[model samples]
Target: MAHVLVVEDDRPTAEAIASELRAHGYSVDTAGTGADALALAQAATPDALTLDRLLPDTDGLALLAKLREVGIHAPVLMVSALGDVDQRIAGLRAGGDDYLIKPFAPSELAVRIEVLLRRTRPEAETVLQIGRVRIDRIRREAQVAGEPVRLLQMEFKLLEFLMRHAGATVSRRMLFEQVWNYHFDPGANLINVHIARLRRKLDMPGEPSAIVTVKGEGYRFDAV
Candidate 1:
């Protein structure tokens, strides 16, 4: 079970959410103030966070900035009644991974929370090697040859996922759904864009490309 920190000022509302999440078998901690929530997050480092936009003590955006400054990398899902596109975009830009408006169904909240948690921690597999590049799943780290290599957020996730089942051809549909969290694209160029970025970054300086594109199928990474 994953731990979730939920920050909301309303006592009844916060308890209600915590109760629902706990019923779903998740460990949940509730905070009624931004200060309290930040303290709880620092102490426990919950797997993910559900932040309320209106905190009695301080601006939620400022609180989020403080959390980011403290290196809290857990995915954040913002709860707010503000449904304007600008507000939503602002939340995203402020490091919120997802947002749900007030009056949301408990089922929707539960599903979204599960998705965020899963995104944080995927199914663990053994070490994956694609050509000369090796990735350790537990650490979510990659290496080219013997030296370490750093990957962008999406790049690392995409590569980590492919390496899990090296040599098994994976369809773009599966990749988009599993990696990008988007399963509804009629045709997604996102796969192509991320792959190209990964290729340029990973296969540079005499490095052989490990990602293979299968026409009419999808892509696969082969361990060599």
Candidate 2:
């Protein structure tokens, strides 16, 4: 069973989420303050975390930054009443794997948690190689033929997902769901934009592109 550390300051809200998760066969623990949350996280090392934006002791983003700085790599689902796009971006920038706005259904939360957990699970191979690109999953870094390639967080994630399913046709819908954790069609161009950026970084002058676009379908990472 996967363990979840739920950090919510509201007593009833915390219990409600915990109860729901327990009903779904997950081990749940709750912390009402950031300090306690950090302590519990270090001691127990939960498989996932649900962080509330507002806490009595400290902001959830601050705690998240500290956790990342210390190498706590568990997936984080940040929940906040603030539904602004900027806030969502901030949470994602602060190491949140996913963000949930307030008034969301428990089922939605469950689905998001499941996706996050699955995405963070360790793969059999620590490093994935395809064509000239080498991805170090452990260090979350990528390289092109021994030259280190700097990738933004989302770009790295996009590349990693494609490399994991290398030599297979990956639909845009699947990419959106797996990489962005959104169950709906965000847009073809949105994913295309990221792929374009990654392509620029991963490809060298006069070299074959690592990612191939499958017209009317999705993308395929070439297997060398």
Candidate 3:
């Protein structure tokens, strides 16, 4: 299980966030102030963190800088009531991996954290296997049912990321950020075009496509 630290001053909000994360199988620790948050983080580094922009003791950006200065490199999701473009940009500039505005769904928060964790965790194995699809990282090759599949550089990267998180839903935003190194959503059909092409190459003649669209949400890569 992944460990997460949630720092928020509002008691009810903190509890709700913690509860949601625990339900998602994460080990959670909560702090109502920056001092306490720093102490907990220094004592035991967490895998991820959720930080509120306003705290009783310190500003979220300052706290984030402090954490980085102390060598706690956990991915942070900044939660705040401030939804201005500048505020959001500042949060991201301060080392936040993602940001969620107030009144957001707890489930969405969990999903964002999930993405953050996926991005930061190191893949120790050189090869990844999911059902019939497999990729050899060292060789930069992909195979399906033991048959070689020719892939371009971008296709290989997209496939590797999708396979790494098989059975989980990945939004276009997540894909753009992780696979294409895009911080802002392009709002274009670029991903759709690539996904369509990938399906053509990856799917067997009579078998269903391995990638399933999760209507209104994102895409999920089925194991088979």
Q: TM-score of every model?
A: 0.57, 0.57, 0.82
Error of 3 at 92 (Å): 3.0
lDDT of 2 by residue, 28-129 (tens): 999999999999989889999999999999999999998888777899999999878789889988889888888765645765676688777744888888
- Among residues 3 or more apart in sequence or in different chains, the pairs in candidate 2 whose N, CA or C atoms overlap within 3 Å are none
Q: Which residue ranges in model 2 land beyond 4 Å of their true spot? A: 122-224
* Residue-by-residue lDDT tens digits, candidate 3, 125-216: 99998888888999999899899999989988888878876777777767887789887878898789888888988899888889999887
Residues 106-155, model 1: lDDT tens digits:
54465567768877787555677767888786677788776788887889
The 10 consecutive residues of candidate 2 with the worst lDDT sum are: 103-112
The 0-to-1 C-alpha lDDT of every candidate, in the order given, reads: 0.80, 0.85, 0.89
Q: Pick the candidate with the highest TM-score.
A: 3
RMSD of 3: 2.9
Q: Return the TM-score for candidate 1, rounded to 2 decimals.
A: 0.57
The number of clashing residue pairs in each candidate reads 0, 0, 0
Ranking by lDDT: 3, 2, 1
